[model samples]
Target: MTVFILVGGVFTGADVWRETAARLAAAGREAHAVPLTAIDAGRPAVGHVDLETHIADVTAAIDAVGEGPGREIVLVGHDYGIHPALGAADRRPQRVDRVVYLDCGMPRDGVPPLAAVPDPALRARLAARAGRGETQGELAPPATHEEWQRWGSTAGVGVAALDRLTALAAPQPLGTLLQPLRLSEAVAAVPATGVLCTRNGVGIDLVQRLVDFGDPVAAALAGPRVTFFELPTGHWPMLSCPAELADVLLRAAAGAGHRLRPADTGTPPAHLRPFPLDVPEVPRDRKGHVDLYVPGEGGARPAVVFVHGGPVPAAARPTPRDWPTLVGYARLAAAEGVVGATLDHRLHDVADYERAAADVTAAVELVRADPRVDADRIALWFFSGGGLLAAPWLAEPPAWLRCLAASYPVLEPPPGWGLGDSRFRPVRAVAHAGALPVVLLRAGREAPGIAATVEAFVAAAKDSGARLELVDVPHGHHGFETLDPAEETGPPLRHAMRAVVTRLTG
Candidate 1:
């Protein structure tokens, strides 16, 4: 028989797991919910409760269960709860047979939950309160239903359940989030299961894609001992789908979830696969920081500078310039009687957008300076995460800049990304776009979080009355240029390119 221990997130108590525990007990399984030092008992002694207090609470739960032969224990952690669960498991590695990371990012050692707080305003306020010598500091729970979504997707949670969740909410200890989780090498041997919640923006497919993209952390998760399961609901599976969640927890304890394969870096990832286009290949000028594809028959032609998206890992092979999508777009532009350019920008991390923007500016200058390029007739095209780089160009379009285009762009940073800068928010910046032509290609099947950003940008653009031309690829994914087949993605891809070209020359 497997015993399960559940740890709830900030602002939650053991009471939050009542339904799930009952379901588990009905299935003849033992279940325990750890009430953290400050969270379950209401908002008293706020600063007195740090991460160690909660870790101790979990350790005590483990002790009560006790370790013996033929006994198995599964520790489940959700959101902020994962920290203490990991800390306790690190201390009692022999007791915990498996650790379930429920609907949360993989927390790393020495990184506090404060670092991953999704809301910018809340994160800033928390930082201010914690940075001060406020011994009584605590974060109040969301008072409204809409505010609850800031923590995670609340889909499938009914009005009554949400009201109960809000009414029972307790202020979280500031210290709990401030302190980091410490782990030892011994815990690495414990098998792990990840329960992904699709509505909260993370799913198994995205994880596998990240692994395929050469992310070291994602690679580590692809190890044999790590398995995955996906719930088609929101973040709080306990409240939204308790029975299903209980069933998943049981299967996870038995190590019956989906296993991920290691990324084969040798083969190009799906996003980097040959762009779904059959354009004639044009010779690329590989000598400069920008790869330029000059038209075969024209001189001083309009140029379109294609900016590839990513906080792509610094270690990712074959760089953006070599990606088939960018290469294909540039060659296709050259084939259409225009100069096309692509560059390798250093957007190697979530926090490097400013630096990436600088790289883009320099690349555009390099492209405009080329002898065969008509500097006054140039368009800037951005893709993927590179979409944020379009902010400055959108906010204040230059006389020489003719048009701006983005394909499946991330117009706004998702809350979890911790991007607090206002300069990178295109949704906010598009209001200042004036009459500059804007072409946006949206992916219908984009990741939920990213799709939200796109929709917000479109709404903002429409409200501002910007010269926006929108194209929807009803069946396309995020990197649709390479992810979807040509028949599905080609029309929009060429149409967006043509729009930019028309703005440049017409």
Candidate 2:
């Protein structure tokens, strides 16, 4: 397929392209991460900062990549890297697949890298920081993540580079910034993908709004040459939410939908609340409230409460992109004679993965407060990322919740980061399992890191007094039931969910 020459910017490395590269490699494509600004960490950094030189470097890199047999190249720019990336793309539009911008869209020509074209918040953040001397400020010592600490200490690069940059860097020749490079020709010929990281609090809806604001510029792009995908995370998501960040980048490159949660848990267990016309929660989670399919024909069945996942506190939404078909879980539970009620947990401020394991405790409380649910037999069935949120409670969940189940769960720092498995390292969540039985499920051909995370969790939980079961299934992928049409179009695929529910409530 097409090749990608990634142009990383100042203050960031090529790390953002890691996951995308890996996925492309896996899919049999070529990708290269081109690093720049080797502008010395010490003084003389000013002399090294040259836009024209950087542009030449990109053109050179493309020529090198194309050496023997040339393939289409997409020169991607991130942050300030756009100045050079766009310039190179303009000089050699024939070789460029598309000049795709991440977070920062196409900046108008003649304006400095610091100029404002669209996205008011981004402009404001940059202006405030630059004004406060972030660019010209003295080089401060670097404090970085533990893993990177050693490398950073050795490299001795951090904030000081900014000071060096400001003191000696060239005043970007104004023409490049002010001139809107003619995209109508190349935009129509080349394919481009715009990855808007929602990590900045900009979701799909917000992305649409921003696009509407830039409609004039967009119309000039010419034809269906560009695409956009929102990664709901942060500005520096590669550092904060790397695994999720990687997933998003891969989705953009592959032209595929992000993974979704599974739906329809076969015949719901008997202990679920029947689909109630009157509804249960009545007010706060009106759109999200559902009946519990209680098991057995008894007056008071051990009711199961369902809690879905959001980044932190679960806000109930009428259009839950993942589990709309959770309705099937309830229908099955009702038929089985159990009460099944799904709820939204209480984490609102959390924006990253560290709180993933910790949020389970709060979810337990929300599920327990329910009147229809039986405190003794409550069970948790979570999917994909939900499993990360659910893992903490597996060891000794509340007295009410009796079982824990998760499918295609992410266990820790994830593979691309190679921080190893954190799922088994029970710190804050160790005390949670008051003796809840746990189940961890995985599709046979899962990505390497997830498999490792699950294995680590199994090993860690081995002697924790909690029962653990690993179910390796025949069909599915991450969030397969939710994202894959094969699973959603038919009834056979719901069998896996039924299998988990059967063990939990039957």
Candidate 3:
């Protein structure tokens, strides 16, 4: 695999990617540090570059790599480099295998980089400079070590590296910052990953803030194709954590050939093993523990929290940590390139809905804190009796939650299940179901009592304008996967699983 590195704005030359490129080369991969034409160290970029010019520069680099059948290229873009890299990918989708956005803004069709700038004054100034026919303008960097520390660059980069960056900094083309990025839907099809710099405080929340502020680039970042990895460093990972960054790039490249969408048919990938982490959120009891399934891959992946059915006899109820069906689901999720977690919440008899909700909350926090998991792209999967406890999440879901799935769920409060707690009623929770999409899987031959409740809950959710997708299993019954894993039930169960996976990943 050939990895193409694009440096950020206001920085000239490919020197910034030297450490990262050397690391990739050591791993037996070819790395190309492609320099932007007008933004180079050889001369002043006073009147020579724009968005189109940089796009052309990247396009030339892609051409030089010699694209053909079975030839794979991974585009790595840092900060402002994202614009040109995406534009090049849009122009050459078949040639580019994957695109990685490193602590940068992801561009959408017709949205300029200036539009996504958080500060209105800076945005207006850049726009005005472009309008005034200024070919280039200096993007001032921190002049002093104290200012550099305040900017979060000194945390990861040493004095020498910081000095090198300062020496290599160049003036950026005003027109390039102002030019609207023209991308096609084909760019969306390319597998994409975002390397978030957490130590610099840049993560999913920052992306969401941009989305909430109506930035198109931020909106695109929220899409399904973009998986995320968190690096515990400042913005300049190339200078500070090159080996780690190279490993992340390698993992991304390895998975680039797989289809972004979950397979509709076929046995899952072979290596479905998970690295388990047992977290005791409540007490020493097994019911208070949560098991996180980290994929064998090296980079961060999205997460799914599995909540199992319960409130039965202790011997009859399977332990959440060792349940075969849940473990199989987690393995399946890992095979599909996502982190999976099975959590144990308090049984209904031991506590009310509030306590169960608290357990789920704790599980979510645990998942978010894992370095191998993307805190933003999390989904909650509730099965059978556990759905009621997850009702609060559906009622007022967090912004980071992508979507949720419930299979053969007990949405309505049964007579003894809730212990007379009114808050356990999932039917009432529908009214507060925010815009988060929900997948409801209903077994066709379910018990009449359970079927009636599911129907009532579905009706209420529809009336409340909740986004819902219902998958009906025509020949299966409740807990079909556990009770009967034969041909009769396997197809429908897999179908429901695929649907939920698609919704969650997307």
Candidate 4:
């Protein structure tokens, strides 16, 4: 027999798990939903309730359930609930078989939930409230559906559920979000499951990409015991799809979710797949920082600079210039009678974008100085995460810069990236690109958050009357050149590439 323990997120109580709990019970599993100190409806919340207080609540639930022979426990936590759940699990690893992270980021040591609050205005307001000692040192729940969106997407939730959620919402103690969650080495021994909510912006494919990019945090998730599952609904799956959530929890407990394979394990990773078009490789000139592939041994011709997207791990082998996609594109451009250049930038993390931009600028200068390249005619093409690097060039176009192009580019940084006020926002910077020709290749099946940024950039481009040419790959995914090799992707990719090459040479 397996006993399941559920912990709710901020402003929520055990009652939110009612429907899901019933389903679990019907399936012959015992489920207990822990009502933490601040949000318990049976009693008034004390002003000083904190994360430790919630951890105690969960530990108490575990004790009452009583671990014994033939009886195991699966600890499940949703959003902010993951903090206390992790703390309690760390304290009683012997009693926990698995810890399910439900629609939330993996909690880090010494970092509070408040630090990652998605809404800037709300985060500032909460800090101000705490500073002023208001609301009895508590943070109130969102009052309306619109307000709730700041927390997470409400794609699959209903009006009735939303109303009930608001009515049952309690004020969360400020300390719960402010206090850092402490864990021990014991928690790492227990296997883990990640339940991602796709509509809210995260999905298994995106997680896989992050792991492939050599992100340390994401890499940690590729451990053998950590598995993943993605739900099509939004943040609050317990409310939106309780039955499905219950099923997933049951499946997770049985260790039946998808396992992630690290990039090294793949013979050649997805991004390293063979290029769609067969073009002979042109010998690369690696004299400077930028790798240059000149067309013919003749007069200087126009150039196209290709930027590979990443906050890619600095340690990943076979640098960007050697990637099959990048190398193939460069070869293709050279075969088409133009110079193609690729450079490895230092976008090792989100915070390093500024440094990466400097590397790119320096590489451009080096590429321009090459006698084989026509310095006055150049087009810059960016991909994926490198999309943000285009902002400065877009905001203030140079005389030698003829055009800009991006494939499945992230136009704006997502929340919690600490780039809210960054100048790297192409959605905002596109407005400043008065006469600059911009080519955008959009992936229809892109991750929701990234797709939203692309849409915003498109809207901004329209509003500004920017010289933008859009190519839509309706059935493609991000890294479509390698991920989706269907004929549909071929046409749009070539069209976008041609659009840039023509602008550079014409």
- TM-scores for all predictions: 0.86, 0.51, 0.47, 0.82
What are the per-residue Cα lDDT tens digits for candidate 4 across 174-265?
88887778887889899999999877766798788778766777887889999999998888999999999999999999998998888678
Better of 3 and 4 by TM-score: 4
Model 3: pairs clashing at backbone N, Cα or C within 3 Å:
none
Predicted candidate 1 versus true structure: per-residue lDDT over 1-506, tens digit per residue: 78899999879999889999999899988999988787776424534788888999999999999667767899999989999999999999988999999998778888878876876667778778767855355788889998787788787899999998999889887888888778888778999999998767667877886787788877988899999999978879999999999999988988889887678747667866888889987888974668999878657999999999887878777787988888999998987889999999999866678789999999988888878999999999999888988999998889889999999898986544555445888999999999899999989999876788899999999999999999889999988887788899999888888888889889
Candidate 1, pairs of clashing residues: 309-386
Superposition-based RMSD of candidate 4 using all C-alpha atoms, in angstroms: 4.2
Candidate 3's C-alpha runs over 4 A off are 43-47, 117-120, 131-142, 146-154, 204-224, 256-506
lDDT of 4 at 447: 80
Give the lDDT of residue 183 in candidate 2: 26
1-506 per-residue lDDT for model 2 (tens digits)? 56777775444445545655676667666778765544322222334344565666677877777533546676777656676777777777777756667655455555556452222333456567655645433222223333222111111223443343234333232222233333234434556666655423223332332222233444433234456666543344434444554555555555443221111335332113232221223212332333334444455555444544433223323322224445555444454455665644443322234454344445445445655455566667665445556645554455666666666665543222112334433322434565566666666655444555666666667655555666655554544444344433234334544554565566
Candidate ordering by TM-score (highest first): 1, 4, 2, 3
